[model samples]
Target: MEFWLRVTRSQITKEIRAGRTDTWAAFALVVRLFREAMRKRAAGDERLWGDLLRYAQDVVDRTPGA
Candidate 1:
């Protein structure tokens, strides 16, 4: 868990450094992170991940220029 948290923080730092600060960028980051965790079997349940991604997608859809 700690290692995953560290990896997530590192990924976020890299994205921020790359100027990915918009809503779509955030959503993309979440998706990439989720996929990585899922591939490693560390993202918990599929239902929870689905809900999270769906909620994020909804937010992005509602955001202007996302």
Candidate 2:
């Protein structure tokens, strides 16, 4: 019983770590996408649109600091 409890806790920790990694990866992706879109627009692409704003808003909405 104790062993299983320890295992469960370990698994939960691993899952949480994985989730954090995923979150960072997603954030980086959004930022890059936003940057690329902006660059294209600056260069007169006209069709480049929509990116990190929504994701950023979500971050602000959820963050305790916000």
Model 1 Cα lDDT, one tens digit per residue, 1-66: 999678777877877779886745776787797776576556455675676678878998899883
Q: lDDT per residue, candidate 2, 1-66, as tens digits?
A: 899668756765676688755654665675698789888878887465544556667888899763
Question: What does candidate 2 score on TM?
Answer: 0.45
Model 1, global lDDT = 0.73
| Candidate 2 lDDT score relative to the true structure | 0.68
**Model 1 misplacement above 4 A:** 23-66
- Candidate with best lDDT: 1
Weakest 10 consecutive residues of candidate 1 by summed lDDT: 36-45
lDDT of 1 at 57: 89
Q: What would the TM-scores of all predictions be?
A: 0.36, 0.45
